[model samples]
Structure formats: structure tokens, C-alpha cells
Target: MTLLTYRTQARWAVAVVNSKKATAEFYDVETNKRIPRTAWTADMKAFAAEKAANVPKPPFVFRLTIIGWIVVALLAAGFGVMTYETLKPTEQSAEQVAMEQTPVVGDMYFGRFEGAAEPDSLVAISDLGFGWFKIVKVEGDTYFVAKSTDMSKQHQPKEQLESAEFEEEGTPAKIVEQTGWQLTLEAIDESVTFYVTDKK
Candidate 1:
């Protein structure tokens, strides 16, 4: 037996059908009334089909509004910025490079070093206060000229030292030996950090 209910303005009409016996019964919800079992009428079946066909169908596609487009555009812009930052060359100041790493010739840097506490001493550009300096000249293992822009008080004199040597004691410092004209300082000083640049 299958029972199908159809709704009217203020009541429900339930059509209970017995398929094996080819009979059906009509029940009224508002009056609590039922008709005696009988053969399925053509009008009743047509009414049921019409009601089934009138049901609202789901939309075929989802639509996005102006705000949705704006959201999508914003997300795209954000992703582009993040990608550019990831792939873009890092910005390094002359002083910041010197503080974190070894001193590179031809390139200038600024920062403080441990051993060169005194003024007018043979101090490496890697050692000093936060400032800018350039390895203006390099002469073998003994001498080098550096121009210092003192940003701190009592700046080290910008001049050439005849006999330059690495600082002794504290952390073992790894100074990059400029074997050729191309100065590559790959020294790693975990204790002292620095930054570098191509300009003085």
C-alpha cells in the first residue's frame, strides 16, 4: 500500500492506494473523514500528477555577486604579493650586512666588531658599531684601506691599516680570505651578525 498526501489551502488530502487489489481510499485532514475503498479515479490520479509536477526545482547553476568578485580579486592580489616577497631579492643595507657576516672587499658594510674596542687600531670592518664602511683598498695579507661613516659616537678613524689581523679570544672568528679580486666573505659568526652591499 502506498499513501500520497497533497496539501490544499488549509487541509491535506491523503490518497491511500492498495496496488495488488487495485483499490484506493481518500482521507481528508481537516474533517478527519475517509471515503470507502474503491477503484482509482482518473480525476484523482490526474490531480496527484499535477501536484507532483508543480514542485519547485533546484537552480541549474550557482551565481556569484559583485561582492564575491571583489573577494576573489583581493585573494588573487594577496597571493601575488606573497609570491613576489618569496621570490624577490632581500633588501640588505651596508651596515646590516657587516654586522652579521664577514667583510667583503669592493662591497661596503657597517657594524661593530669585538676585538677593535680601541680607536685607531687595525680593526676589521666587521667589528665596530652600527655604521657604514667600505674596504676601499686591499693589499695582500698585511694591509687594507676602509672608509668609515661613523653613525655612532667616537667613530673609528677612516684610514688604511698597514698590518690587519683577525681578533683573538672570545669566539673563534672565521674571516674570509680574499684570495682574488672577487671578495667572497662566507664567514659564519653566530655570535655577531652583519649585512653587506655593493655600494660604499
Candidate 2:
């Protein structure tokens, strides 16, 4: 007996025959599994023909998949950077902090007077003698402080201190110049701590 094999338009179907009796068996080529003849419909035959003719090759599909993953990874990294920037704490430089704490023009300093009628009185730097004063100008390490009319009230006169009418036009009564180390020493020697109330 001789065996014979034949191919069909379904592409996946195979026909086998023997001299004694002819018999045929169909298979799904993609899965290499047996398919019953009854299950091989016209729609399945058309889909198989379309797939074989129109589908992209495996290598191109694999490349597209790789590119998609790369795009996704890049997006994730970008989002991570943005999230870190948004959530990270903002830090101020030492120079910025010092600049903010240092006195500027139109700034008012308040200190407590020991034996005065009111304990909290607007006073100049302790070494400059006890009197109301405001910073008129700043030049390098020098602070030109000018004497102002006395404000011996218990509460800080923030409104009056910031008012334009409060400014005086004349030579500065005192010029306090100090290095960083000297300022630190002055801070230590001062009996009352001076704090800035208003900043221009």
C-alpha cells in the first residue's frame, strides 16, 4: 500500500490516503492540532487566507512591542522626576536666610527698655544708646540708623513705623558697622534681643 498527502486552500487542512482506503484529517497549522472537518467553516477559511496575506511578520511585531515598552518606561521616568520635584522640600540657602534676617531700609527694630514706663519700647541698638530709631539706609556692613520720635507704647507701632510720614530726611545720627563676628558678639552682649517688626 502507498500513502499520499495533499494540501487544501484552507492552508491548515491536510489529506492523507492509503491504497486500501482513502481518509482525510484536517489540522490547524498555527497550533498543529487536529480539527474536525465539520468545524472548518467558510468564515474560518476566509480568516486564515486573510491572516496569511495581510499579517505583519513576527520580527516587525516584536520590534513594535519593544518600542511600546520603551515609550512606557520613558513616560514612567518622566513622571517620577516630576513627582520628586513637586514633593521634595524646598531649602533656603544660608545667604538667603541671612539676607532676610539682616536689616534693610524702612525696617523697624524693637527692643525692651529695662527701666522705662513701658517695658516693650521701640529702641535703637543697645550700644547706640536707648532711643527710638529706624534704619534709613544700608551700605555694605554699615547700617545708617536715624533717631525717630519716641514711641513708648507697650505694643509695637507697626502701622506708624511703616507709614511714609514716619520717615525723616536728615543725616543719620548713628552709623553701626560690624563684621559677621562682631555682630555675633554684639548679639551676645545685648541685654534685650532686637527683632525686626516691619520689612520694606
Tell me the lDDT of model 1 at 60: 25
State residue 23's C-alpha deviation in candidate 1, in Å.
28
- TM-score per prediction, in order, is 0.30, 0.26
Q: Put down candidate 1 lDDT per residue, 47-153, tens digits, no spaces.
A: 65665566444332234456666777899999999999999998766544544444445545433333232345465533534344455444443223243433444
Position 139, candidate 1: lDDT: 40
lDDT of 1: 0.42
Off by over 4 Å in 2: 1-87, 90-133, 160-193
- In the range 17-102, model 2's lDDT, one tens digit per residue, is 22322234456676777776577678655555554444333322122245566777899999999999999987866544543566
- Model 1 weakest lDDT span, ten residues long: 14-23
Worst 10 residues of 2 by lDDT: 180-189
Off by over 4 Å in 1: 1-28, 31-57, 91-173, 176-200
Output the TM-score of candidate 1.
0.30
